[model samples]
Structures are given as structure tokens and as C-alpha cells.
Target: MSNDSPKLTPRQQEIFELIQQAIATTGAPPTRAEIANQLGFRSANAAEEHLQALARKGVIELVGGTSRGIRLKAGTLRGLHETRRAPASAGKSRLGSLSGLTAGNLPLPGLEQLVLPLVGRVAAGHPILAQEHIEQSYAVEPSLFTRTPDYLLRVKGMSMRDAGILDGDLLAVARTREARNGQIVVARLGDEVTVKRFQRNAQGVTLLPENPDFEPILVGPDTPDFELEGLAVGLIRKDF
Candidate 1:
């Protein structure tokens, strides 16, 4: 270890190791929730406190306003690599070559980015864009989609399977009240949020599911709970 390296507690060391393991496996640091789950912490706040401690000790760097912003400092990074007792084969891990993964001190690209909140669940009576429903923010290139997205909502079911949308996919949505007749959209009915093909006529509005197993949702123009949240512009699917 370098002479300037700050001393770390045993728990801090364990957390640091877990962070590296997460980066090696997923190309990003684990979220506070993930770290809390792995370390048996009572809440994500506990993990956040430990991370603050690590940042103060100069072992790692944290970027403000970013959820997965943890980065191992260069001297600390090299020291950690040198202290590893694993076999040579283990050096082949992805962490060995993480160049270009980060821009500036951040662990992910910070340029040409559009940072939008990723919505998880919509509670009844709360607005769709309520702060409580935003799970995290994702930075993606605007050019990745045909239209720039206002937010990304996690797909909950396989109702749009025939449209090539599956559960666990991230549906990039453009905020708009008007959608073309055949456009895919994020529709809000009462407390339920759904992704489906939009069809509107003088009779009513219909949310058509692409899969045969699911039935269409018909909403009358007078329905107070029915609202058009956005148009589906892109999809992000992660491979395990």
C-alpha cells in the first residue's frame, strides 16, 4: 500500500471488496439497496453512511447526484489489485481492464447523456411522476431512441410480448398527451400503469395488448382516471 493510503476499518474493507466485486460483475457499483441486502444492513441509509466514510477516507470517490457514482481512486485501485491473493487466472476479471468505462471520475459515461428518472411503482392517488415512485435515474444517449425520453418505466408483465416487449425491460417514454392511433404508449388507468398500443375513436379509447392471453382495456372519454402518460420510444433489455 502507498504511504498516503488512508487506514480503513475491517467493515469498510469488506464494503470496498463488495463494491469491486459488483463492478467486476455488472460493470457498475451496487446500489445502496443492493449493498444493504448483501451486507444484511437494516436499511440503505446504513450502507450510505459507510460509503460516506469510505469517501472521506480517500479510498473511493463519489460523484454527486449519481446513484452508481462510486469509483476506486487510482492509488487505492492499484493497491487493492496488488494486495489480491487470488490466482493469475482471476486477474482475467473484467475489472482488470475498465478503461473507457468512465468519464472523468464517474464510473459511467458522463457525456452525450440524458439523465431521466426510472419509475418503479405508481401508488394509488399519487401522480405518475411523483418522487416516491422514482427508483433511480439512468443516463442514456438521446440518440439511442427515435425520440428523446422523459423517463424510463420498468415493464411489469409480458402483455406486450408479441410486440417484442418482455417483462423486466425498460420502456423509454416520451412525455406527450397526444399519441398516434397505432403508437405504443404508457397509459394510466386509475392507479394502474400499462404499456399498450393506443387506439382512439369517437366511441372511446382502447389499450390493446399484443399478447393473446391478455384482454384490451377500454376507457371512455369521460373516465376521470384515464390519462395518457407518454409514448413508448425505446426499450432497454439487460442480459443476466
Candidate 2:
């Protein structure tokens, strides 16, 4: 058995599944509170305890203060021998293939791996979709972002040129259904997607453009529904 597949109690297995789902869907590991909620525990501490147990068993790694920071150990795959053998070559296959089967295909060091698709445009505050907006996907480690971002946005306009987020730059975006004050975010207003520095007031939220020439956009307390797709985590520039 692989070291990644260390035996665990049923509770640990449940926690493992929850962490996997959170990482797959959110680009980050689930929080203690989220794990608790999913497992129907009354307190987040309960989930934390279980997670601690998992960490001790070498099945998962954890990064504190980061959402969805749990990384499943590689080499945990249970049935590698069955998948690797071709029927005709089953008898001739090398022992290395059977011995090398792990929980995941990549090495353990790559557990925090995440591949984010570069999107062409965002619907200003709406989620970036691979089918409709993605230009390409780049492999990245989740730790590169302050918060794990769900996708990358390909900037198209110069509204944020002054902020070093130039047109054509790829913006790493952390997906959150909600937004807080003073965060650089990808927002959707109507069908349009825009990147702006976000600020909020009692009156409403303002989407501020980095360039002084561009005016800040004010959203009324109530108006068209807006979406907070994600926060800007990092940027990458391609060479001409």
C-alpha cells in the first residue's frame, strides 16, 4: 500500500472526501467551518480535530488561514495494477508500474497543483466560464495566490493600466460568491465583465478604475443584479 493511502477511521475518510470536493470546486480547501457544516457537526472544532488527525496520518497537508488549503497526498490510488495492464501485455508488464501506482498521478510535491484557464472576458462580476470565455489554461500552484483563485482572467481594457494590470495581461482570480470592501475584483454588470478596485459605502458599492481618466462606477443599493466572480490574486505578462 502507498504511504498516501494510510488507513484511517471512517470519520477521516468522510473528511477526506469533503476536502477533495472543496479543492475541486473552489480552488482552495474547505475551511474548518465548511467541513463541519458538510459533515453535520455542531462545531467547526470537531471538523478541525478530524483534519488534525488526517494530517497526522500523512494523508493530507494543511495550510492555515487559506481557504481550501488541504492537499491530498499523492500515491493514494487504490487499484493501480488493474488500470495499468493492457490485456495483451498483462503478463509482460514491468513491476515498476505496479510499484509506482500512487493516489494521484503526480508526485507528492505537486499536491497543491491547480490549473486555471485563461478567460477572454468576464461578464463584469459574473463567473468566468471555460466554454464561453476561456482562452487557455495554465498550470499553477495554489500557494502562488494569497487566496487560491478559481480562474485566470485575460484583461482586455486599459481601465486598470495604471495598476500594472495592463491590457492582455492574465489576472489570477480567486472565486468567491461574495465580495468585501477595498478588494480588487472581477465584477459583472449586465452581460459585461470588468476588473476594478472595489469599495463599498452605505449608499452602495463603487467599482473604481485604476486610471484617473476613467470615472468610478457607482452601483445603487438596489439596481441590476451584480456578481462578484473573484478577487485578483496575481498577474502574468506574456512576452511579445
Candidate 3:
């Protein structure tokens, strides 16, 4: 940050660092409740107040109407993408010359690009990333995904159209067995695999679709089989 930029309080600095760490590890910003829980705040309102303060300081941009809509500014985002390995020799700097590149661009062929498998339809009782399920592989910019993804799954329907996740788009998936409320995920039920928002309640688990016409998939105690394949980390729209 520039010296001219507005300064932050100690608490704000702590919250800011927490945000960076969350995005770096989980590929998505933490929700207000998460921030409050992590920092010992009594409620999410305190976290919201602090977030507003941070926004005024120009370190983060918050989009309303979404729980995980917080965005790190460009300067801070670069810090999250920095590789953990030690620097190269004098002649082989990782951040090479930028004569034809813009600042914060990290699409260097060998170092910054991510080769991800593109998964097609999955067979019953088989792994999602099975060899037969992989249609092809694509070399994508690591920055294109919030978190480094394990594979790209081609969306099959408009169930998530309201979320801007359309049919034929590539859904970047980070393989995980767990998910928090309101986060979108790719889940498998019996022999079927579908993408939907994940919600856990005392009653049971609910797989919610973004479109109103589709009914939520409710998983109760007697459900035959339920498994969480992965979390939806990013999206690549082909039609756009």
C-alpha cells in the first residue's frame, strides 16, 4: 500500500490479514460470521462494522447480497498469489522482465500456469477424476481460479443460472469433503452428480439450486447415499 493510503487500526489490520489467509487457503473470502468467530467477536455485526472500516481504507471491496463477496484489492491480491518457494538465481528470477506484461500478471508459462483436467460425465460408483471421466486437459492461468482447482466440470443444465453458472460453462472444482452454508458445491447422490448450493440444517442437508423451478435435494437420515465430491471454487464461461 502507498504511504498516502489511509492507515488502519490494529484490529483492522488483523481482519485484513485474516481475509488474505482465507482466500489463499480456501479460494474464497470468509463470511462475516466466520470473521467474527475467528476473531472472538460477539456477533457478525462487529465484523461487518470492521469490514466497513476496511473498505473506507481502500484495502477491500465488498459486494452486497452475497455472504462471501468480499474482494481483495489488486495490490493485496498479488501477495496472496506469491509462490512460497525461495527465489531463483540472478539470471532466472521468477518475476521476470515485464516489458510486454502488465503488473500483477502471473501467466508465466512454466511457473504460473495450472494444467487442470477437464472431467466429463462420471459413471456410477467410480471416482469423479477417473481416467475415463477426463475428457481433456487445459492449461489455465492460476489466477483465473480463486483457489487452485483439481479439475473443470462442464455444467449440464440451467439449475444454477441465477448464479451466472450456465450450461456448458466450466466449473472449477477444488476437491473437498466439507462445505459451509451457502457455498456452491458439486455433490454426488447415488449414481448422479450435480452442482448446487450446499446447506446444512438440524433437519438434514439441502442441496439448493439457483433456479426457482428446480427443487432442493433433501438428504435425511435414511437417505440411500450422499457424498460431497468437491467445492465450487471458480467458473470459466465458454459461451461468454
Better of 1 and 2 by TM-score: 1
TM-score of 2: 0.50
Query: lDDT of each structure?
Result: 0.70, 0.61, 0.70
Residue-by-residue lDDT tens digits, candidate 1, 1-240:
434678889888788878766654433467788899999999999999999999999877765544555656545654544444356535432231111112133223544677878898898788788999999887765533435678889989988765556688777788899887867789888788999888889988999987788999988867877889988765555444
| Residue-wise C-alpha lDDT for candidate 3, range 1-240, written one tens digit per residue | 333446789899788778765654544567899999999999999999999999887767776655765766544433334432224322111111001112134334555678789999888889999999999876666653455689989889988765556678777788999998877889988878899888899999999987787999999988876889998766554422
**Backbone collision tally, model 2:** 22
Off by over 4 Å in 1: 1-111
Off by over 4 Å in 3: 1-111
Better-scoring candidate (TM-score), 2 or 3:
3
Q: Which ten residues in a row have the lowest lDDT in candidate 2?
A: 93-102
- Indicate whether candidate 1 or candidate 3 has the larger TM-score: 3
After aligning candidate 2 to the native by TM-score, how far in Å is the CA of 238 from where it should be?
1.1
TM-score of each: 0.54, 0.50, 0.58
Highest TM-score model number = 3
